[model samples]
Target: MAILVAFGTIDGAGLARSEDTSVDALQLHGPLARLLRPLVRLFIRTGMTFPALSQLLRELYINVAEYDFALPDKAQTDSRVSLLTGIHRKEVSRLRGAGAPVNVVPAALSRTSRIIAYWLAAPDYTDTTGAPLPLPRAGEAPSFEALVSTLTKDVRARAVLDEWLDRKLVSLDEEGRIRLEEKAFVPQNGSEQQLYYFGRNLHDHIAAAVENVLGQAPAFFERAVHYDDLSGPLAAKLETRSRDLAMNVLQEANREAHSACETDAGGDWRWIFGIYVYREQMKPADKDIGKDAS
Candidate 1:
C-alpha cells in the first residue's frame, strides 16, 4: 500500500478544499507514482495499453466523484462531477450513466475460501495444537465431506475435492486421508482466483491506509518494520521467521473470527485481517545511494 500524507482536510462533500487542493495534489504525486509503478508493470505485462487504462481511470474518477463526493441532500450533477474530477462535463455525463464497476467475488472462490478458513479454524477440523487435521475422504464429522458441508450443501464434496486436487491445494495421502498443502489457502499462481484475491486484498489494505491518511478517528492498525543492508542469508532467515510469526497471528485471528461469526447476528459490515512479507535484494545503485546518504 502507498503511504499517504494528508495535506488538507476533506470537506463534507469528501473533497479537499480549494485552498489546499494544489498542495494536497502535489504532496500526493510522489506516493501515487510509487504505488502505480508496479501496477503499470503489470498492465504492460498483461498487454493493457495506456489508452485503455486512461479510459478506465477516467470512468473511475467520474464514478467516485459522482457517488462518493456528492453534496448531501443535493442531487449530483454532471457539472459538479466534472468540476471535482477535472473531466469534461460531457464525458462525465456519458460515463456516469455507465455505472460504477461491480466487484463480484466468484461463488466458487468465496465458498472455497470459507471452507479453507473452516478447515484451519473450526474446532471440528483442527487438531489440539490448532493445526488443521488431515481428514478421510468421506463419512463422519471430521472428514473432508463434513468440512465442505459446513460451508455449502449445494456443491458436492467430491467436486470440491477434485477442484482442490487439480489446483494442488490438497492431496490424498497413502492412508487415503486428504491433507491440505502448506499454502493451501493461496490460490494457484496466474489463475483467476489468484487475480481476484490480488485485487481484493490490495484494495482492503490500501483503503485502510487511505482512511487513516484522511484523518479518520481511531486509525486503522497499520505498521511495518523495515531494515536495509541486510546480508542475503539474514534476509532469508528473517523472511522465514516473519512467515512463521505472521501465520500464527493469522490462524489465531481466523479462529477467533470464525467462533465469533458462528453466533454473530448477521450484519452488513465486513472485516479483513491480512499479512504480507516481502524481501528484495538491494541493487548496486541503490546501495551506493544509501551509502552516500549515510
Candidate 2:
C-alpha cells in the first residue's frame, strides 16, 4: 500500500506519497511541515547563499512534492534529475542523509512520500504538462525511507560548491526534502552585467520610492545609518532640516558609506548616494483665461 506524508513549506504546506511506512504528526506542526525540508538544502548547494535563502524562505517557501520533480511524463524523475543536475543518484541520497527538518531529533530520515508526492506533482498537475502518474513503469515506487536514502548522496556535491551559495538558498520542507533557488541566472552578455543584477534590483527600487516622496525636488537618502548615530546630534539636525538640507545630508551620509545599499518599491537598487534625481518636473502654472477670450 502507498504511504502519505505531510510537510511544511514556507510558501504553503504539501503532501507526498511514497513507498515507505507512514508515521505520526507534530502538534505545534502538522503532517505537511514534517515532510518537505531536504530540498531546501539542495537549493543552497546549487549556489544561493544563506541570507538570500532566508529572504526567500521568509517571503515565499513553496510546498513542493515528489511529483514536481519525480513524475515521469509531467515531472522530471529522480534518475533524470540526477542527470540534469549533474549529481549522482547515490550522491543525492547521501546529501539528504545529513538531516531532514521534520523529526524532533533531526538525525535520521523520515517517511514523507505522500507529502513529497504532492509537492512533486502539484506544479506538473496544475501549472505544467505533467500528469497524475500513479506509479513508475520501470520500478516499484521508492519506499519513503529509500527516497531519503537516495537523496542523501548529494552532500558530497554540496561540499564542493558550498562557498558559492548562501545558507538561505537552502531550505527544509516538512517532509525532509531539500530545495534551492537564487535569482534566475541571466546570461552575461558583457562585463559584470549579471553580477550587477542582484545589487541593481534593490538600488533602483529604493531610488524610486525616494523620488515619489520628494515629488519634484531631487531626493537623496543615506545608508548604513547606525542606531548610535540616530541617537546623536546628527539625528536631531536631520529631524529639523529642510527638505533640501535633509537630502544633502542623506547624500553626504551615503558618500561616507557608499558601499551600503537599499531597495525600494520597484525592486531596483542603488547605494545611498548612488541614487540621485538628475531632472525635476516643473509644477503646473495657473490658467490665463483673460488672454484667451476674443
Candidate 3:
C-alpha cells in the first residue's frame, strides 16, 4: 500500500513525497529511525550511549505507568510495572532505588515572561482594543514602574527597564515613556534563553509524541513538512517567510488562549505552542566520499 502525503511548501515551493515505498499501517518506524539518527549523534556528542538512555527511558515508562495510568488499585507493583515496561520485576525494583524520580512539572514562567504576559493581557497595561499601552516610565499609579512593582518589589523597575532596553524589547521616547516593541519576551542575542527553550520545548513535544504513539486517544497535534533538496538561499527565504506567518498566527492564538485561561474557573491545563525552523547541511554522499577519499 502506498500513501500520498500532500506537502504545501513555503510561498509556492512544493514538497513531493514519493508513493513508491510501501506504507504499512505501522510504518511509523521508518520516520522514527530517521529521527533517531540525529538524536543518537547528539547523544554521542554529549558522551552518552543507547544503553544509558534506554535505561532512563525504561525507568520513566515505569514511573509514568505507576503514577499516571489508571490501574485497578491505583497503585503500582513490581509485576505490573514489569508487564507495562517489559523490564524484569527484579530490574524494576532496582530501578526504583537507582536514582531520584524525574519531576515533570509545568515550566515556570520567568519574571520577564510574567511582566510581558501581563503587559500583553492586563487591562491596565493594554488599551481596550488589546494593544499594549505606551506607559509612563515612573509614577505612583498606572505606569510601567507601577506594573513592575505589582510583579516584584525586589527587582527594581529601573533594573527591569534597563534589561528590556538592552534587549530592545521596549523603546523609550525622549519624554521617558516606554512602548512595547514586541508582544512576547524575546531574548535578544543570547544562548542562555535558547538553551533553556531547547530543553523545555523539546521535553513537552516529545512527551506529546510518545503519548500518541502509546495509543493515547485524541493525540496531540504534531505535524511537519520535511524536504531534502533545497538550496541555501531558497531555504533561507522560506525560513523568513515561515517566521513572519507563524508569529502573526501565534500572537492572536496566544491572546485567545490566555484570555480563556484567565476567565475559566478551573485552570487545570498547561500548554505551549512552539514553532521553529531547522536547517542543516547534508553530508556528502557515500560515493562522493569514496571518490574524494579524504
Candidate 4:
C-alpha cells in the first residue's frame, strides 16, 4: 500500500495533510504498511494482484483528493486535482468523469446483522436488568423462534440457531433453551461474513482513529495498554482478566445506548461501540537465537 501510494504521488512522496504530526507520521503510517502485508498475501491467494488494488485505489485517492483538498475560485480543475493526487492530468480528467462508488450490501447479511441488533436492543429478548435472557427454542411469542421470525420470515429459527452455534456466539442447553454466549454475533466462517466484517469493523475502527487525530472537542473512546515482555502464565491470566473486564464494560454500555436510543425522540444520530482483545507472541531476538543454536 505504501509503495503504491508513493508511486502514485508526486516524485514518490505521498499526500499528507497539514495537521499531520511526527508521532502520527511514524506510529500510524508505519504500522499501516506492516498491516497490509498479511492482507496483501490474502489478495494474492484470491487472485487479486497489486495492479487490481492500484486501479481501485486510484479511484479512492481521487475521491479523497476531490473532497479533502480545498477548491479555489471556480470548479476543481483536472490540472489542480492531478497535482494534489499525483495522478497524471489526463488520467485525473478520465477518473473524474467516472461514476461514484456503489454500496450494495447483500440482503441476507444485512438481515442477519439486524437480527443481532434487535436481539441486543429489544426488551422482549432481555431480562429486567437488560441482560440477554436465555430463551426457549420454540413455543410462545417471546421464544427464540419468535425472535428470529420478527427479523425475517424467510429464514427458519433452527437455521439461525445453527449459524450462531457454528460461530460460537450462542449455545443450546440440554433442555432445548438458547443462550447468548457472546455480546455481539459475529460469523466465525464464510466469505459473506468476512466481507461484512471488513466493511463494518475496519471502516468504523479507521474512522475513529482518524477522528481522534483530526477532530477537536469531545473525543471518541480510543485507548490501549501494551507491554513488551511477560511470562506465558502471567500473560494467560491477564488475557482472561482482560476479556472479563472488557465484556462487562461493553455489555453495560450496550444497555445504556439501547435505552438512550429508545427514549430520544427527535434525532438521526447512530453510533457503535465495540470491544476487541488481541495478543501475539514476539519472534525470538537475534541474540536469543544464537544461544539456542549452540
* Candidate number of the best TM-score: 1
Residue-wise C-alpha lDDT for candidate 3, range 1-294, written one tens digit per residue:
112222321111223333333445466665566557777898898888889998778777767766666477665788887887688888888775453333333332377777777777766777776778889988865689998988887788988889888877799888878999863456544345555665687777777655555544555665565455567997788788888878767666767776786778885677788766776765677235323322
**Per-residue accuracy of model 2 over 1-294 as CA lDDT, tens digit each:** 112122211111222222232332343243234223444565576777779665444222121222234555674444654554455566544342232232142221112222233323333222233322222112223322233234455434334124213434234356543343222122234324333443454445444433433342332322221112133454555444544564456434533342232232444542323322211222232112212211
In candidate 3, position 124 carries an lDDT of: 72
Residue 70 Cα positional deviation in candidate 2, in Å, after optimal superposition: 52
Candidate with the larger lDDT of 1 and 4: 1
Please give each candidate's TM-score.
Answer: 0.88, 0.15, 0.67, 0.70
TM-score of 4: 0.70
* Steric clash pairs (candidate 4): none
lDDT per model, in order?
0.80, 0.34, 0.67, 0.68
lDDT of 4 by residue, 11-33 (tens): 11232322432344555564576
Indicate the worst ten consecutive residues by lDDT in candidate 3: 3-12
**What's the lDDT for residue 141 in model 3?**
59
Q: What C-alpha root-mean-square deviation, in Å, does candidate 4 show against the real structure?
A: 8.2
Better of 2 and 4 by TM-score: 4
> Which parts of model 1 are misplaced by more than 4 Å?
1-23, 99-102, 284-294
Worst 10 residues of 1 by lDDT: 4-13
What's model 1's overall lDDT? 0.80
In terms of lDDT, which candidate is stronger, 1 or 2?
1
Q: Give the candidate order by descending lDDT.
A: 1, 4, 3, 2
